[model samples]
Target: MREEENIIVGISIGDLNGIGSEVVLKMFEDPRMLEFCTPVIFASIKTMSFVKNHFKLETQLHSINALDQIAPNKLNVLNCWKENVSIQFGKEDLKIGEYAIKSLSEATAALKDKTIDVLVTAPINKHNIQSDTFKFPGHTDYLNQELEGNSLMFMVTDTLRVGLLTDHVPVKDVASHITEELITSKIETVYQSLIQDFKISKPKIAVLGINPHTGDNGVIGSEDDTVMRPALQKIKESGKLVFGPYAADSFFGSNNYKSFDAVIASYHDQGLIPFKTLSFGQGVNYTAGLNRVRTSPDHGTAYEIAGKGVADLGSFEEAVFTAITIFKNRTEYNTLTKNSLAVSKRKRFNPKN
Candidate 1:
């Protein structure tokens, strides 16, 4: 594992036409941020300089041709593309989307090769980012494929953590998607992530229902009784403290979510609506259950507020800090587990019974 002090955060500059650049520049403007981790932005130095000049930001930049020359305490910009790209604030441009993907792809490569410790991505335009080479709905979907493990869109903050059982799936297909296997796998991912990533020992996870009042004894819908309950029961039998299929309508309103370690919503909006409503600016979209650590601000490409110089730096800063914290937590967890395994092997091979 890399040392705690020298953690390198790989940043993907998302949607140059949106508020991504603004948040990224604003977050690193304060010299104090470098004390936490060295930020290597995966974008052209020229593009970043243009953005800096437009934003009138005083934060300095260090341009590097490769990751090996990354300097400590300086904002490094790795030139992913050298071509001059036009920037139009608040406009959906396919050319800009290509650059966003380029940044993300290189950052992900660095993360996979251990060149960077973690990744904190800025928001991207989901619609414009579709092309022949890249066709992911969002960052989570793309990273899920590139990374080692199953990805869970774990939206998190100090007080709350919400994971989705099925993300980026349409509402009409949501019920058909939430099978017993899907439920089990998603809950297991959440459970393991809590222990390994968040350092929660014995996590209690709650699942929101598919239908109102959990189908109200099959009156509203039969999915809760047939699918969700059985899956939760099987998980419970396996010794995990998993509960729910609670009414999605009143789950957060009643503050019942506070009783659990993390809540797994049935779908995207079911989870995100409450999460954003409660912790919008302060939340981080943490991609949990993957081998590499990655996080992003909960809000997406704010086209309306692009280049306005009024974007909130709260969420972006929170994403950076969250990425660092999770990286350290996972490192410590791996070390402890390895030591435990070694001890177990020694005990098993001992001559004395």
Candidate 2:
């Protein structure tokens, strides 16, 4: 068995009304989850108890006030929210939104403090959670605000990875959001994330144009030729392996995406359409450029199947595994870089006999 000290995974219980609790309960029932890391859930003990009893799952829950109290072979619960209210399964309630946000905030804080290695977040409802206190669209936006620099949402499968230049924005506003600076920054972030987190050194990134046939060379729209092309040129000059302004229509038809490490699309649909067509229920949604690792199942809350006990756990499983893999890879890469630099320094200072 792997030592518990090496792996510590923090989990955020998403909306108490959604399938988040059910999935978390089901996941912890798997004895193998302890083999990879000590799982710590940031939620109230009462909330988790309701879930375990409602689902009739055979999992043990240990309540702890702080992350340092996490123990191996036991499902640790870091009670961040008080169980002052009632939770109705499969029902949307504004009251639970605050609790959901609290769990996420506490989990993120722990991650920032390095108390946890990776974060596996459950699904959250954007409509219920958006309020005066928590105005962000979703976890991606919240994470962006919590970390320095920009962050992009990337959906990943075993064979394909797609990054969104603009997410959770209306189609009318997508063009306005796709400015030269935003496009360039998002692409750079995606490239860097693929290399650093996914371990794809010298990553090849493809940029998808905003219009059909790449704006037909300025006939359909000048955004592709004037804005996107200019950004691509600048990126290319920086010696980064970036290509395109390729027409969004034909880019995925020829299966050209396989040649690159990731694809950056101009809007949410432009990237997600092809990604969902290929990845469907098996993809993992990862928020890149945050100080801590965060990943969630690509699919939504699945309200219809919330308590049916039939919701596919594949995506949830994949999300947790992806977080673990990235955490380990990042650790190894940092060690290698430090060792290489030390060796170079020693070689430069050594005197010849």
Candidate 3:
């Protein structure tokens, strides 16, 4: 494991025409952030320089061509591409989308090779980012393939944490996608993530029902009782502290989510709508159950506020902080587990040696 100060965080600059660059630069404006982890922006210095000038930010940037050239205590911008990119705030340009993919793919590769300890991606436009190379719905889908593990979309804040059973799937297709296997896999992923990423010992989890009032006892829908309930029952029998298939409507309004370590919503809006509302738009979207740690601000490109220099950076900063903390937690967890296994083997082989 790398030293705490030396933990390199790779940043993917998403959607040049949007506010991705603005929030990223704004978050690193404070010199104190450099003390937490080194940031390496996988984008060109020229483009970042233009954005910095437009935003009139005082944060200085260091340019590098390779990962080895990264300097600590400074905002390092890796030149992923050198060609000049025309910037127009609040406009959707397909050309800019390609650059977003470039930055993301490079950062992801670095993560896989251990060149970067963790990754904090800026928000990208889902519609414009489509191409022959990148065909996934969002970051979670792309990273699910690039990295290892089950890959659950886990939205987190200090007090409340929510994971989606099905992410980026349409409402019509959500139920068909939710099977016993998927329910079991996603729940297990959230449980293990709470332990490995957040350092929770006995994680309590609650699952939101697919239909309203958990299908009103099969009146509204039978999938909840037939599929979700049976899956949760099977998991509970294995001794995990998992519960629910609870009513989504009143859960957050009544503050019932406060009881559990994490909540699993049946679909995207079911989870994110309440999460964004309850969290006050300050949550971090963490890609959990993966071999590497990756997080992004819960908000989107915010094109309306692009280049206006009033973009709220609380979520972006929190994403960076969360990524660093999770990386450390996962590192410590893995080390301890390996040591315990080694000790057990030694005891078995030679009890008194």
Least well predicted 10-residue stretch by lDDT in candidate 2? 1-10
What are the runs in model 3 whose C-alpha is more than 4 Å off? none
Cα misplacement distance, residue 237 of candidate 2 (Å): 2.5
lDDT per residue for candidate 1 within 48-117, as digits (tens), equals 9999999999989999999999999999999998888899999999999999999999999999999999
TM-score of each: 0.98, 0.94, 0.99
lDDT of 3 at 115: 93
Clash number for each model? 0, 0, 0
Tens-place lDDT per residue, model 2, 233-295, is 998999999999888888898999999999998889999889988986889999887666889
Ranking by TM-score: 3, 1, 2
For residues 155-258, what per-residue lDDT tens digits would candidate 3 score against the true structure? 99999999999999989999999999999999999999999999999999999999989999889999999999999999999999989889999999999999
Superior by lDDT: candidate 2 or candidate 3: 3
Q: Against the unseen true structure, what C-alpha lDDT does each candidate score?
A: 0.93, 0.85, 0.94
Off by over 4 Å in 1: 351-353
Model 3 scores worst on lDDT over the 10 consecutive residues at: 1-10
